[model samples]
Target: MAFVPAPGYDPAYDPPVPYITAIPGGLRPGMLFYIRGTLAKGYTRFRVDYATGQYEGSDIALHFNPRFDGRDRVIFNTFQNGAWGEEEKKKDTPFSSSRPFELVVQITQANYQITVDGKPYHEYSHHIPMDRVTWLNVKGDIVLQAASIIGCGVGSAGSKGGAVGIPGGLPPMVGPVCNRPAIPFTANIPGGMIPKRTLVVAGHISSGAKSFIINLKKYSSNDIPLHINSRMIKNVLIRNTFLNGVWGEEEKDIQNNPLQKGQFFDLSIRSGDQNFKVYVNGHCLFRFDNRIKNVQEIDTVEIQGDAELAYVFF
Candidate 1:
């Protein structure tokens, strides 16, 4: 089959492949569909499958597995108990870490072959019929260089018109909920609480000793602004070493000012995923992402001494 390069992808920078429509429907035994690519630190594999449509196997189609050997090769194999099943390895061939050039076979009968950097590296034996293997994929964060489906029936699996919906795609975490967009926090300053427009922190602020009492209120609600806070959150303490005492929409640079023993620092967070930075004693003490999003209310900013103020950029 001919392999067409995906649209919106830079073909020259990306590995090139023939369009999938040129290949014939049937082929002699021992044909292979080979893909070449580069791997990095992020997502690293791809899978193409016809099983989503009229195929007879599970929804999974074709897939690329990264080998976990000390070398950087990728693969998928059976695991026994809690460790790598030595006997389950496809071959005794040692894995390679040098930039790998690999190959895969889509056979009409028994196991298939996988070669890396042009060498016959591994073999896979499966019970599934090759006719049932219509889908294909190149998984992971590997940059696909080129691919060729040497056998037949290697075109796109029609469309996803009738596939059933799959759920539970997200993992666990108190991720920012889009529906509940607003989060409010209140600080109990030693003096009468003054409504400060912003609250900032440098690092882990110790509890008590003139700490900013930040509360996340109504954060669990769906009606709040997703960019701010979606719920009625309040009084969530944001500990810092230098906290500026100013508010408004203009961005102002904070002159490095000494922080008192009980005064927390003020951190300025820029829009997007910019780092939160604080200035203390004429020097930048710390900078990091607040990691929390959707903030609205700043009930108070308690300080042992006077707080330096500045406008917010975003």
Candidate 2:
């Protein structure tokens, strides 16, 4: 799903090497993490583990080791009851000595979808309950650049990676914060929707909700490259684009019920070269062709209506 790191917990710049930070909440589906780093000279191996405790023998759920071990392979296994599980190794390696790389891992209910340098690489099924795994430990011969955790999924109590209250802890606000502000808010889409960067909107459908609108456009102009409106009354999700203040044709062939009243939904909009893909509840619901040619100009997002949004991160 398209997602932004939870507020406050997102790193502003490249973090220091050999870093340790609490997974703000814990692992859950729809959450994402990435490690940007370079292998050190004479690098033999590096390991990234998701564990219950920092101490040794603390029930590690996933032990990811990329090694040069002469044969050049990547091994994945579990450590339980103070013992290591049988290793599952694949020859496909995404790292090189003293070279920089980015690894993005997306957590789902059953598996972790890992991609290296924007390419599909591998999948690791969960050996332990993902939510029970807390700390993220990265060690071995590598230089860490940046790492982040984002919370935007169904029932994910992911590391808040930020300051203060949990993602869905607060009462769902219908209107404004404190008093004057509105719940339908807009925030900066950092780097302006770069490919591989996701846009996540999380919210609960209001009990008596009729509809809601999520628009992606430029602040300085009315050219909306993407306009997603969910009409619960009609049970359809409307997709459109506006050019020069003129609305284009509508798209609603997706027969799936994209939402349910009084329920929570995670909406992800992924940027592709030719289309803007939308997912509801982790299911692909719409794919709108790139009507706005230049996707980078889509800088502003606005959401307001019958749904109470938990957060929107891009």
Candidate 3:
């Protein structure tokens, strides 16, 4: 049976074996497919397929198959014209038995980048037209706890016109719809953050890490409306603004280091009429009064330094 997805939400969240669904925006550059699950104790092999439809014999653009019994390798290949392509195999297997796992795959113009946990895994270039692949099929020896697609940017999914039509509207947003972005990343705040815009920065602090910074600044000018700096050894989280290259007074009253080394953290910077509220793990951490009067003009957000960025949504 072809796996037709439910409207308004990705079917990856559905509870069932042989998890099947349609990618909200199809496979676009900058979108990400994330699967979090646990391999059964007697796991042998499993396949995650991105295909044209739910038909048993449809073409699959990316066939990510990991075998634990045969060769203990991860195989990446494609299916077209009812045949499989040459197998591209990796000797290492990051999946473990009786343990949780996280696999994030990022789509780009050139190729697909796969990452496990927080480290990069492999890169597979496109053989089929990326836009033609719209269905997501997952099956094999794993207890699928949660499967999701982040990074579905604006205007990419369920859009009408040409390549692939997203059946449901856009996938529901958990936040700003960002995929797995690499560290030292920078992107424009879509529609220029109006009041009540929530910006989230999430990642794991690297072991032996030093510091990291997340800043929201103007795209054309040098006015930094919000600057968040975290120092590990000094144990200080600094907040300030930089306008015309002149820095404002630093606010360092954060009592404890909210972010710990080797731990994952979810930090939020939400724009308000009078200030931007910052939260760590759902707790109100900092509130910076509106430094730049015109909030809609702050167009860019930048993250850099020591940390493995899991996700960034603006």
Worst 10 residues of 1 by lDDT: 171-180
Which residues of candidate 3, in runs, are more than 4 Å off?
1-21, 34-43, 53-59, 78-88, 92-132, 137-200, 218-223, 230-258, 266-272, 277-288, 310-314
lDDT digits (tens) for residues 1-314 of candidate 2: 43333232333124555555566556877777667678987788988888887666788888888989789899999999888999888897978764567677778898988877657788999999876787788888877655756553323333343343424332111111111125577765655665434576655678899988888877778678899888989888888988897999998777676566775566777776689877765567777898766677777788877976644655
The prediction achieving the highest TM-score against the true structure is 3
Candidate 3 lDDT, tens digit per residue, 61-162? 999999998679999999999899999999899988855677888888999899898689999989889878878888988887556566443344442223
Best by lDDT: 3
RMSD, candidate 1, Å: 22.0
> What's the residue-level lDDT of 248 in candidate 3?
97
Q: Which structure is stronger by TM-score: 1 or 3?
A: 3
lDDT for each candidate structure: 0.31, 0.69, 0.74
Considering lDDT, which of the candidate structures 1 and 2 is the better prediction for this target? 2
Question: Relative to the unseen true structure, what is the C-alpha lDDT of residue 72 in candidate 3, on a scale of 0 to 100?
Answer: 94
For model 2 the local lDDT of residue 165 reads 42
- How much lDDT does candidate 1 score? 0.31
Worst 10 residues of 2 by lDDT: 171-180
